[model samples]
Each structure stands twice: as C-alpha cells, then as structure tokens.
Target: MYFERAHISDGELLAFYKALLYPRLVEEKMLLLLRQGKVSKWFSGIGQEAIAVGATLALDNDEWILPLHRNLGVFTARQMPLQQLFHQWQGSPLGFSKGRERSFHFGSRQHHICGMISHLGPQLSIADGISLAHKLKKEDKVSLAFTGEGGTSEGEFHEALNVAAVWDLPVIFLIENNGYGLSTPVEEQYRCEQLVQRAAGYGMRGMRINGNNLLEVYHAIKEAKRHALHEQQPVLIEAMTFRMRGHEEASGTKYVPPALLEEWARQDPIQHFEGFLQFLQLINEEGIHDIREALKHEIDREINTALAEVSPPVSEADELKDIYAPAPSPIPPVAGAATHDKRFIDAISEGLDQAMVQYPNLILMGQDIAEYGGAFKITDGFVARYGKERVRNTPLCESAIVGAGLGLSLMGYKSMVEMQFADFVTCGFNQIVNNLAKIHYRWGQTADVVVRLPAGAGVGAGPFHSQSNEAWFTHVPGLKIVYPATPADAKGLLLAAFADPNPVLYFEHKALYRSISGPVPEAPYTIEIGKANLIQTGDDISIITYGAGVHWALEYSKQHPQLSIHILDLRTLLPLDYEAIREAVTATGKVLILHEDTLTGGLGGEISAWIAEHCFALLDAPVMRCAGLDTPVPFAASLEKNFLAKTRMHQYIEQLANY
Candidate 1:
C-alpha cells in the first residue's frame, strides 16, 4: 500500500527524481562521445536506474558500496563529480584510477567505493570481509555489493553469502536481475524459478520485487539494510528488471528479440517515476523540464571541461611507481646467543603471536587455524591467546578467505591468510592475481594482506600436498614473494610482511617446519624483503638458490669442501637482490641456479638469463640450472628422491667446476 502513495517527504521525492535523471543525461552524452570517437566504451544503465539509485540512497554515508560496471547511478547517488567520471572515460589523469583504468573500472577512497574488475562475482566475498570488519569494530555501518543476475552462478557468490550468513556480518547483497547476461537470457543461465530462492540455502532472508518500480526498490532495500545493521545478518534482494540497451555502446542488441525489447521499454523506470511525481503534485511539467535542462547543461559543461584538460603524461618512472610500498625504516638487530632455539613451525607461530599483540588491527584467517591450531599445528595455542574473534577459522573455501582478506585490508586492517596446503592456492588464483595484485596499481589503494603458503615436498605428502608454487606468483606484478629457508628468516620475514603496506606471499617449506631449528631473536625483528643472505663464501663456483634448495646447496658444499663453493640464498623472489647476485657471480666466475620447482619455466631460468645478459664478461662458463624434473611429484619416496634437484646439484657443480 505504501508503494501506491508518496512514502517519502516531498524534498526526498524530488531528490530521487533528480538522481534518476542524472544518469540518463550523462549516459546519453557518453553515447554521443562514443559516436564521435571520443570515449572508448559505455555500459549504459538506462532502463535500470531505479535499482541503483534506490539501493544506494538507502545506505548511510559511512557505509561502503562495491559497484559493478552497470551501476553508474550508484556513483551519481553518491554525488561523485561529473567531471571525474568524464575524465575517466577520456583517459585523463584526473580520473579516480589516475588514467590506469577505463570506464566503470574506478573507485574513490574518499567516497568508500570499490572499483569493478571484469571478473564478475569476486567482489561479493570482498564485501563480506568489509562487513566483518564493521561488525568487529562495533560500527552500525553496512556494506552493499552490486552484481548482475549472471554473477549469481559464480562459486564466489555462494561462498560469500555462506560466509556472511555464518558470521552474521552486516552486508547487503543486491542482485540486479536484468533479464540477460550480455546476450544469454536468464532462462538458459539457471533453471531455478527465481535466483533469490538460492538464499535459503545460505540461511539468509531473500526478497524479490519489481525493479522497474522505484518506490518498491527503495522500500525493499531500506528494510534489507535495517535487518543487516540491527540484526547483524545479511539479506539478498533480487530486483527484477531488463537491460534496455546493449551490453556496451558498440554491442548492438541483435540477439535480443524486438518484442521483448519493446515490452521492457514500455515500462521504463524514469518515465514511471516522473508520472508518480506529477500525480503527487511534487513537481509540475515546467519543473520537470527545468530539471532536465539544468542536468543537461551541467553535464555538457563538465564534458567540455574534461575534454579541454591535458592528458596524463606517460613516463618510464611512472611504470615503476606503486609496485610496492616504500620500505619501512630499518630496525636494529638484537645481538644475542638466541633467546631460544626453536623449530621453523614454532618460530612462525611465535612471529604471528607477537605481530598480533603488536598491532591490534592484525587478524588471522584460515581453515582450522583457530581451535584446531591448523593442520600442521603451526598455529597451536593461537586461539587461546588471541580469542576466536581475531584468530578466525574460515570455511574450506580458498577464494572466500583470500577475497575477504583483501576486503579487510582495504578497510585499514592487516590480514594474514593461511592456505591448508600451498597447492590449494590455485583455487584462489583469480583473486590473488586480479584483485590483490592490481588494487594498488589500478586504483592507488593498499592491500596490506599476507598469504602463508606451506610449501615443498619431502614428507611423502604426494602431488596435491607438496608444491613449490612461488614461481607462479613471481610473474605477477604488485606482489612480493618471500621464501624463507631458516627459522630466523621465517620469523623475521613474517613480521616484515605484516608491517608492509602491499600484498606479500610467504612460502614456508613444509619439510623445514620441524626438521630445521635455530636460535631466533626474542623480540620482533624485520629482515628487509629484497635482500638475500650469503650463506657461505668460496671461489670455485656460486650456488644460487632459495627454500629447500638452500639446504641442498649447504649439504653439497659441506660434502665437497674441496670445491670451495659459494651459496647465495634468495629470500625474496620478486625484488631480487641483483647486487648480491652480481657479487656472487663475479667472485666465482661460474654459477649454478637451483630451485625445487619444476625445471622448465622455473625461477632459475630468470636468474640464469639475467646472469647471461648482464654478467656475461664475469662468467667463466655458461650458467647451469639444477631443479626438479618436469613432472608431477611421485608418491613413492624412492621416486620422489630422483625427481628433486638435490640428486643432480652435486653432479652439475662438479661438471661446472671442471669447466
């Protein structure tokens, strides 16, 4: 009944009408720019303005919004400047993404908005994490995440909803059911009668409404927000509408039937809302004409101003900026016999414990990490010390864990995520690569998150459990990869990673968890990420390696002291210490690069190539590499021994020494 009348105040009704008009005017201008070859692309929300405007207006100012490409009205409702949007479309530096991204792929930290990636549903899990942060901070604010009907089919959607429901986080999942995903109709996408029905499986309330009715969308979202904030629960609202325009400006609607298009056009939300405003006498025809003309003039002026502005300069220095946060001030090393000789696992646990105590904003999330102390007992006694609130044991969903960590990091929290096994990281590869690795470069935002990967093979864990996957992440920019070979380095690097303002991937060799023990500092200490440690010095040859390869090199050196070999442990894989590498290569005049990862396409290849290109004159012989065979790790111990680099390092060193 309330939907049949003017439920809001006269002032608010007029404001909503203005919000509806703002996007239509701007989008029409964008279409013109596309036609004139000024803008690259435009994803119009012409028919579904009500859903974006109503849902966004229902939120508090402190609340956050994770918008999709089609939700331009959300930005309009937030009062984002028209010039900024036009500059973004024009690829100018004044844009939110600093000209790094194009249309609809930008966000504002000031406005508490997140940019969208082409990957559709990952933002949902990220919103779940932000909502968790709000709940933990005891704030009443809720986060609203926008996605299309097609996104509901992604596994991340189910994982996000389940996590939010389990934790009772204050998050609102708004699904804009616009009848098609690009071109495929909803009937072919899912067999369910309604997509909102899936919410029952996640133990959340679900609501479906006529998305074209602006008043119904507004009221439904207001109620959903109330439930999320007051009850500390998530709610899913499906606003049924249709995409009147093509997916983008260049995409024609040839796939959509003419009769269906006519039916949706007849129910346009802007026209319907204008009729309602006139019926309530809130505005007259003259007033409507004034509003439309004023918006058009304002948009035209902004577009012209943006076009007149100079574009951002392209430079070689700009290519290197924001790849990593500035290195923290050096901490004085504590001199001692060692506070305690601890195993690798104990050192890592102690490091995490000390970091949690040092920074209240630091939180830990992983499977069986809280009460169970993790599968490897690395986090033993953590929950008892830090409580279940900070030390959270998440579901067996890697993508959700990583996505939520990214969300928490965005909200000024340092999150440490643990994968049950390093091999399981493949499940979250999309988030790690697309979102975590690109957030800073794409939008000038920090993702202060650390992912702990238990890696290596030696305990007969087989292929699934044993993997040295650091090489997979080294190829990705904006990511710092650390491989610690000792208890002390493990403790130091973990602390450093927590303090860093960028995303870090820490690989802890599973074999060294207990087998390796050394004296560690009693207090927190940080080892610079890009610096490598010179394990031993000699003149015959330089053995370059990291992780388990460090141990193999040490054993080979000790067994063949007559060879006088030098070993350089590369702790950080991405920001490698080229100076240290050059020193090693120059000193020995012969080099051998070794790693535990597979031979072809391994990190050793990069190091070897660099040595060949930069240190060619310093080399006495061609650089050689000893690494794992190009095959999956066999389950048998006998077969595994032959598959590793340890078997061939000694032989390769002898041949290089003879040369």
Candidate 2:
C-alpha cells in the first residue's frame, strides 16, 4: 500500500502524520512509566520520530531494516504488535527475545528486523552481509542500516562502507546525524562539513536532507532503495536531525545549549507533519485531537495487557536454553570407507572442496583467496572450481568480514571466514565475541559460521603469525572450538564444524599442514566433535593434549618406552570430552595437560583443575601441565625452542609415572 509517488494524496498525508505521532506518544508514555518506577530505562525519540517512520514506511515490507534504540518508529511502522514491543521493553518472557534482552537489543527474523547492539557501527557490516545474501540469490531487495554521527567514527563504519563499495552490495548506509552522541557535540565528532562527502571516497552515491522533514526522509529512502537495487551499488544517506532529549533519562542534557534546544523544538517533525495534514483538509484541529486520544487509548491498553502478562518463573533450564542449536545431523561415513594418503592441508582443502559441492549456499571469504588461492594455499584452485562469487577475496577487514558472515547466516547461508593468522583474530575479536557468539543467546537466531584460524608455533613464524589463541574464544559461550592434529581429523573435524549449526572456531596448526600425513577418507565424512581419539591405552600417566601437542605426546611415548603412557587427543577443546577425560584419568590414575598457549591462562589450567577436583581419589600423582612461558612468542629459534613446552613435560611425566 505504501508507494513512492510524485504527487501526494490526502489519505497518504494523514497516514504519515499518524505514523510520526505514534512513536512520539509511545516514547512520552515510556518516560512517564520510568518516573513511576514501572519501566527500567528509556531512550526517547521525541523529535526524531520522522526519521524512523519515514524510512521504514518507504521501504518494502519484505526488505530488512537495522534500527537503533532511538528508532522506535521502525517497529511500529513495520506493524509489530504493540503488546509484544511493550513486553520486550518490560523484560517479560512473552516478548521477542523472551526477556533474554531488553529495549532494541533483540531482532526478529519474522519481521526482517535486526536490532542494534550497544556497539553502534558493527551492524553496518551486518547490513552489508544481508545485502550480500540478496545479491548472491539474485534477489532484487535492499537493506537499510541506521547509525548516529558518533557511530560513523568507528573503524568498522569505514571498513563496512569500503567493503560494500568494493562488492557493489545493495545496502543503504543511513547516518542519522543527530547533533550529539551522548552529550558529545557534532563539532567535536568530525571535521568534515557533512558525512555524505565521505561516500565519494568509497565510490557510492551520497545524499543529505533535513530529517525534520518527514516527506523528505520518506522520498530520499525510497529513491535510495531504488538506486541500490537497480544500480547494484550501495548509497550513503545522512539524515540531518538533532537529539532533542538526553541520551537516556538517567543522563541529563546539561551540556546541550538551551538556545539549540529551542531552535530544534520549533522544528518538531511530528507537529510539522500534523500541520500539513490540517492544511491539506485531511484532518482539522478537532480531528487531530480525536486521533491523538484514540492512539493514547490504544497504547494504554497495550501497556496494561503487557503488564498483566505474567513473566515465566525463572528456571535453570531457561538460563541454558538455545546457547546452541542441535548439532546438524551428520552424514554417516561409509562402512569401510575408501581411503588415500593426503597431507594435513590437502585433507582440509579436499574437505572444503566436498563441502562447497554439498552446500551450494556455502561462502568462503578471506584475503587473496579467490584467484591467488590463499596465503597458505589451503584454498588452492577454489576460485576456478567454485567461481569468484562463492570463493571471495576480502580486504584487510577482519572485523567487518566476520560481521558479514553473521549477516549471511541470518539470510540462511553458511559462511566461513579465514583469518590470515590466529594472532590476527584480535582484529576481529569484538565481532567474534560480542556479535557472533552472543547473537544466538540474546535472540533465538543461530549462525552457521566457521572461522579458520591458522594457529601454532615451531614454524619460526614469530609472535604475530604463530599463536594458539583458541583459548581466547573457548572462554566465550555460544561458540564451538575444535583443533585437529592428524590429517584425518583435520579433514573430518572441518566437515563436522561446517555441519554444526552454531558459530565454530576451527583452529588448524600451521606446523602440521605438511609435516603430518595420513590415510584420510576419499569421500566427504565427519568426525563427531567433543570425542577424543585414544591414541594408545596404558596403565601409566595420561597425556591430555590437542592440536600440535598430540604429536608431542606421541613422541614422548616413543622416548619413554618403559613407561606406559596413555595419550588422549582432544580434537574439540570447548566440549572437553568429559567422558573421555574421565576414562583416561581413571585408567591411568595420573594426568598431564599440555598446550602451546601460555601457562598463565591456557586451557590446560581449566583441564588440570577439573581433573584434580573430579579424579582426586583415582590419582596416583598430581595433575600437572606443561604450557608456553607467560610472555610473547619468541622470534629467535633458540628462545622459541626454550619458550615452547614440547619436551618440558616429558621429564616430569616420566618421574610421575615412576613415582
């Protein structure tokens, strides 16, 4: 029913007035509730209602919108049930996030809405990702993302804009240029005369308009959407508006000039739109009064109904629900599956080759991955086989690409991101920890994303290139961590990670890429994650290790042939394989945990503590660990050899076995 027209109608003008007024009234009522101690917090959109209403209404119903906390009109204009919105704000279980999140902290796939997180700029990349999905499917749809002037200062904002421009993604990057960002003035924010000018640097269309003009915002967004979809390129739009209230009720606006407030007050968007409706003879002053009363009554009833809806009793089950979706039902490996010898990297590459064929919607993104293959050649010849679209080469924007992966997952595509080095994951840490890992737990939405981390040492790659930082992500919830040692596991576990429905951090040791070779399945197969491989059973000490440490354990067993050493290869680090760990500890009665990460905060600390607590009576010796020194990875070979825990644990374990 909403269409972009050259000539306006009386009915359409009245509808816009109503749409603008609705969120204004709702925000006002929410503030009153906050004063009465009924609502927890409020971010008012009193003067800026026009921006949300205009843009959301202008976009197609099936298209997506990413709105910030101040954009309540985005929800109402999209026709989301008022009761549900109220219930969400009130943190009631009947709400969209089931009270797991509050305010605009949740998203609804059914509504095609992705709510904004506190980090304002990451969603720019997410919008780019969703737009990427539309382009991949050849669907003529566009996504609109909103941010404030302050959010534009984030590096992710620049990264996202550059990525969209390069890929020609169909997304509208709308900067809601509210004069202040949490009391910070526009003069202090940036030196540019206007934000839209930066669009030229990224090679995109740019537009700026007075956000107080509801008609202007509507028309601009409609045209921007049209341009994005038809031209197959993104557009940057800066809506020049003012924040007429405090950032939140608790944060008063003492910094804002009284004269500035008065200036913007006279330009109130809702009042101006209502005046247009009256002038058009669509509604009189008395009719305006009647409509306001009706809207107020409807909101009051919706609030009351939401309040009366009982919040479900808190339970432990609620606390643990949906942290992960069910692990994808895996394809059964053939009984006596045909096998062939392949290097560790070859197996991984082969597994990905089979995966690309199996999942047509699968995407592989990294730096120089397309025609050049990859930095490590793990994706050699992938572009020629899968085409440039599926096998993508990304800019040096780890943060944005990770966020885009989540966006792809949102639109029902499985995504894989290759971090050039494991230590480089620090660049994309926020996207991984705050965004990807927390999305599922906050909402019911799970992402099928895999980040391949080339981690480990002994290759003389130095600190930045050689790091086993899988422990960093293992601490985060809603993420699965897997590290494989042998060629077979390198292949099987990679396939298994792709099969899992949650976000997975797949760590591949650079040291084992070619050094390790074994007979691996010729066909696509998966090894169940969280299940340890029992290398050998012995009555002596149990060596609990993963990744490169598995090879260390095997070598130690050979050196100390007299000692009965039981080596357990923990392929999946997150799940811990508790049953296998218990079995190993019970059988050996002594435990040695080893890892390449530093001794201070490595995963071995947790594993050692767990074994100590659970298997105390069964222990013949104290649970010990051998991990890297508490310092940066050394650059020199002698120092690196001394810094590593390769043979340090062997002597202690032999003593313990003898003891």
Give every collision pair in model 2: none
On the 0 to 100 scale, the lDDT of residue 612 in model 1 is 90
Off by over 4 Å in 2: 1-5
Instruction: Name the lDDT value of residue 637 in candidate 2.
Output: 95
lDDT of 2 by residue, 1-659 (tens): 12234577767777888888999889888988999988798888889988999999898888889999899999999989999998888887788887888799888888889977899999999998999999999999998899999999999999999999999999999999989989889899999999999999999999998898888899999899889988999999999888888898889889998998999999999777777666657788899999999999999999998888788887777667667777966565798989999999999999999889989999999998888889899888998898999999999999999989988998999999999898989999999998888888787888889999999889888889988888888889888899999998988999999888788899999989989999998989899877889988988888889989989889878987898888999999987798899999998898889888999889998888888888788898888888998888888999899889994886768778777
Candidate 1 lDDT at 322 equals 63
Clashing pairs in 1: none
lDDT of 2 at 351: 90
lDDT of each: 0.89, 0.89
